[model samples]
Target: MNQSMFIVWRESVEALLVIGILQAWISQQSQSHRLSKFLWSGVLLGLLLSGLLALLIMFAGDAMSGALNEWFQAGMALIASLLMVQMVGWMHRHGRSLKQDLQRHADQHLARRGGLGLMLLALLAVSREGSETVVFLYGAGARLRGPELGLFAVGGLLGLVLSALTIVLLHSSRRFISWRRFFALSEAVLLMLGAALLVSASERIGGQLLAMNLPEWVYGSVGDALWDSSHWLNDSHGIGGFLAGFAGYRATPSALTLAVWLGYWLLIAGWLRQRREEPLPCLG
Candidate 1:
């Protein structure tokens, strides 16, 4: 429930922020009412598309069972992890430019293609985030049952409502939230969550490989348990649990998982540091 909630919140907040920017820009221009209608239409269409995608995920999950199901799940988990990285990185790099980019897009599309272009742009933007949310939550929701699943849905709904309220408040005040800080905090959380998903996916894939009669040696190397640090850093309880849910914390990781985790951090962190240290262009 918590996992789904956070991802939903983060994704929804991002989408809302985009819409808010569009609305704000439209308000400042001529033909503002036309632009508003186009934007709202885009949001409505996006929500319907999201619902359809969610249904597709449900049907697909139900269609596969047993080994095929495991493989499918493993694949989804891997995809989810990769998507998380892409989302966080994209947001970090483009967040500051989001408003400007959206405004430019609105201007160009509004001038060239009119309302239809605006609708298409909004649909594409919202659907991208919406579809991602569907895939991610579907994969995560599969691990829960009964009341847990219900709670997860509740969490997602609350996240959407809260995000909408936030957008409304920010719009009314005409004050942009600090996109940099918002994205930074969310990116950190996502990085950790991606780690957890990666570990889970790796373990699942290792299992599938074994089931397919892969050499025991391959599985052994990939699945060999490393040190158990659950005693000191239990991912299932307290703060460790929070970290586990937000970022993947493994009490016992395979050799491959450990190496991959370390390598991923080193590469991403190094690049981030370099980017941060680079001198900014002096404005004349």
Candidate 2:
């Protein structure tokens, strides 16, 4: 539920930001009213397409069983993790100029094809964010069922509401929290979430491999726990469980899990260092 909520909140905020930028630019144009209509039409169409994608994923999951299902779930988790990392890196590189770039594209589209071009731009932008949200939610909540699934849905709705409120607050008063601060905090959380997803994918893959006729040493390394830490903080329940879900904390991790976790952070660290060396644009 928590994962679904965060994924929705983060992605919705980004989608809303894109719409806000386009709308703001439209308001400055001569045919503001007409352009606004086209923009909204595009947003609605994008949302509809995203809904279709969600349904498609749900049906596909329902159709699969046993090993195929496991493999599919693992693949989705891996894709989601990679997408999160890519999203964070892309945002870090382009966030400062996002507003300007959106406006520039809007101008070009309007000049080339008028309202139709603007509509297409909005459609593509919103659909990209929306499609990502669907995939992320499915990857995060694929194992949930019954009441847990209901809670997941509720969490997603809550996230959407919270995102709207957040946008309002940020636009109204940056004295409390600036856009830079918001993105920075969210980026940190996203990296942790990515780590958790990667761990999940690794565990699933490791389970499958361990079940195969592998050598004793390979089985020991892949399946055996290095050390037990449940006495300190059990990862199956309470706060520890939350940490496991949100940050990849494992009380009884195998060698594979540890390796994946460590590698993820190391890559992130190197990426951040490289980003820091490049001059950043002003976030005005």
Best by TM-score: 2
Q: In model 2, how large is the Cα lDDT of residue 28? A: 91
- At residue 154, give the lDDT of candidate 2: 95
Best by lDDT: 2
In candidate 1, what are the lDDT values of residues 1-284, reduced to their tens digit?
A: 68887888889987887787788787888888977898899989998999898888778878999888888887788888889888876765666667778889988988899988888889889999999998788656666789978988998988888777765664565456544445666778887777777777777777777666667777876767778888898878898877766666778877777776787778768867867853322111
Instruction: Provide the overall lDDT of each model, using Cα atoms, as 2-decimal numbers.
Output: 0.77, 0.90
Residue pairs in candidate 1 whose N, alpha carbon or C atoms collide under 3 angstroms: 192-246, 192-247, 192-248, 193-246, 193-247, 196-248
Residue 13 lDDT in model 2? 90
Question: What is the C-alpha RMSD, rounded to one decimal, of candidate 2?
Answer: 1.4
Clashing pairs in 2: none
